[model samples]
Target: MEEKILTGRLYDVQGFSVQDGPGVRTTAFLKGCPLHCPWCHSPESQAFYKQLSWMSMRCLGVDACKQRCIKACPKNAIELGVTQKDVKTGTDLQLIHVKRDLCDNCGKCADACYVEALYLCGKDYTVDELVNRLLQDKKFYDRSGGGVTISGGEALSQLDFVIAVLKRLKNEGIHTALDTTGYAEWEKIAMTMPYVDLYLYDLKHLNSEKHQAVVGVPNEVILDNALKLAENGKKLQIRIPVIPMFNHDEKNIRDTAQFCKRLGNAVEVVQLLPYHNLGVMKYLRLSDDPVAEATLPNDAYIEKLKRIFEEYGLPVTVH
Candidate 1:
């Protein structure tokens, strides 16, 4: 492929994440996903478009600073407003509010904010640009058996850009991993196989009906893709998020392990990712409803879930 710009939106680029793959990795979180998993840790990544993230506490307020963002907004969507009065103290704070309905997400406000109190969550990067950035950590990757991981909202949702980045990384001898939900078409996934060294595949639920009800899609395609990937000799480390209300039952656990067992030696490992409310605050940043509170599964419960996969003779790790 010729060297050129191949821009795609990404919410974050995290470094030294040991849990994502074999070693410390720089996980590029591409924006957008087909499924709306309630327990998602990276809620900001769901939308493919750039999001305006306003931090109220970081704001210097109208009195202390020039409101460049307010003037820069083409839609007049930004306005200075009193923060909602505290019911207990009856004290109202001053803040800037973005009328999301009118806001076009042009990111003009983000550029105008000198304090960076207002910022855009996603940014576009060219293939060459992103590769150069990832390659900066080459020494780290070489020493730690680490490389770059393409994660998402759903990495495959931006398939072309992902393949381009992965191909370049592979050329530079950097191991590449694709952390996907496996909800995308098989053809798209197959297109990424040559560039990807490992697949961090997520298995949400065993029952198709339950899966659709929660995640807004049928699991058949996801399951079929997993099996096919394994059959075609792709390395898979199946990741299962153990949500309390959603697939935590004994039967569900056993069924999942049995399914992995069916994949036989094609399965590399089964990672139990216990659900947490780590991204609940992130939802607030995106002006989305926060997930209802749920207690994280205790260590013993996680261990029990791990043992279930062990019973099936599949390698299991609780993360």
Candidate 2:
């Protein structure tokens, strides 16, 4: 193999994550996604470029520490303004806002922040460096059946680096999993399949138009890739996010279950991931508006959906 030094933009490395995969996996969240799911919990991971995020709660205002960031910004992107009024204290506080058009994401403002309220969303890490970071939790993986889960914005978006890291992990006998949207080219999927033990595949909608409307991509490619994976004997888990006013109708639920049923034993799990508004704050942090107006499905409704999948002889779980 040619000597490679591929680096991937990472947002987080959450250890002991039982939700992402089997056992206690260390989920490495990669930045940059191809999809724009309205119910995306990790809004920070959507962009391919580095982004500055400001949390108003941690800001001490210009009066407390002076305008270090405003002065440090070379492009004059940082400024002090009365962004909001503190409702509990009834105090008018000046907050730092980034003029996104003028800002070049230099991180000077983030560096100048004493309280670290403002920071960059993505960090670059070489394949070896990331694998080493994840390997630190090898003891936990040895004890449990867990390993590392390469999650994203979408794992396949960074296919080469992901494959490189997965190959290294596999070399160490680590059980690897990939949490993806399955929107990438078929060749890239095939390249990573052998290294990955499990595929936490997302199946948002069966209808192409509805999928494109909500996720900003047609489901044809996703469905085709999924069938290929199943045919290739790669393990799969079809993850469905139960969003209200979107795919919560009875017809949609049955249709999805029937589709998963066709995949047969290739799909080891059909996980119903109910929608939540947890990402609303993340959108605010990035100074962007949320696309999802739908509320989360109730417990009873979630259970009903689970039963529908189970009726198709498919193993189902709600999260």
Candidate 3:
């Protein structure tokens, strides 16, 4: 049997996202990741398979449902429950329970439910499908010098698919940026480098041991790729997500600054992305453990870190 080409699961194609890259960008979030970073913001993007996510806020109580899901479920995954009682009338509001094992991927429950309590996370798309969607925002890309950014669990994990998409975009004269962890093989990085305009390199940690401890992989490969890109004179922007207990200290900051400085003048900027609980709900949806109970860093500490990078004389942005 022939090997199949693994395309990518596109979670969302967000238009006019300014924070992801310079100007206004259309970001295509690819699915699957090798690194299991504790503080990952898009936890849904990690898994390669199609998974279910429920937004509790969007759920309507059982009063409106017709029990279609209970009948549709093959594994008896869907169960009815009395959610609450009316204060005066003493009537019960029912809800549905979904057993993971019983789910047959039929999607009948999601289709039948009137309220959007259930949602599927990932789906496959071809290169043409992705390019056509991105081209819809060409006017904005032209106006703001913004284009498409390929972000993921890690974009490089799907090397051939990403390259195809990027090459297609370049052929159509669209500016392209890649938000990567730089954990890919050097050859794969080099292959995509020609088509990519800017590189958003993530600097997770300077210490190899600590990097492995948090992200479940060694930092050697990532660091090597970063240096190779820098050596090739690629326009690189180093992004460091300042986690409270991880790389928020002065030592790591200084070391990263030095590394960026060693990249010569090609690297013109460093972005300090402060950690947040934005993805906490995702952990519950995936039934996984949360990374840390630590709080977000205060403004004073963030400002202090900014000054530390400013000592390197490179432009720094704190978010």
The best candidate in terms of TM-score:
2
lDDT of 1: 0.87
What are the RMSDs of all candidates, in order? 3.3, 2.3, 2.8
Q: What lDDT score belongs to each candidate, Candidate 1 first? A: 0.87, 0.88, 0.83
Clash pairs detected, candidate 3: 62-94
| Worst lDDT 10-window in candidate 1 | 84-93
The better candidate by TM-score, 1 or 2, is 2
Total colliding residue pairs, candidate 2: 0
How well does candidate 2 score on lDDT at residue 258?
86
lDDT of 3 by residue, 1-319 (tens): 9977546677778998997878899999988889988888898888877777755555566556667667766678777753866555676666666777667656766777667677778878887788889999999999999999999988888888999999999998999999999988899899998899999989999999999988899999988888888889898888999999899999999998888788877685899999998888877765534456568999999999999888988789987
Residue 144 of candidate 2: its Cα lDDT? 92
The digit string of per-residue lDDT tens for model 2 on 1-319 reads: 8886689999989998998878888999999888998678888899888988888898877776788889989999877766667767777768877787788888888999989888988999998899999999999998999999999999788888999999999999999999999998999999998899999999988899999987899989999999899899989988998888888888999999888877878999989988888888888888745454576678998888888988888998888
Q: Give the TM-score of candidate 2.
A: 0.94
Candidate 3: give its CA RMSD in angstroms.
2.8
How far is 242's C-alpha from truth in model 3 (Å)? 0.6
Q: All candidates' TM-scores? A: 0.92, 0.94, 0.92
Q: Candidate 3, overall lDDT?
A: 0.83
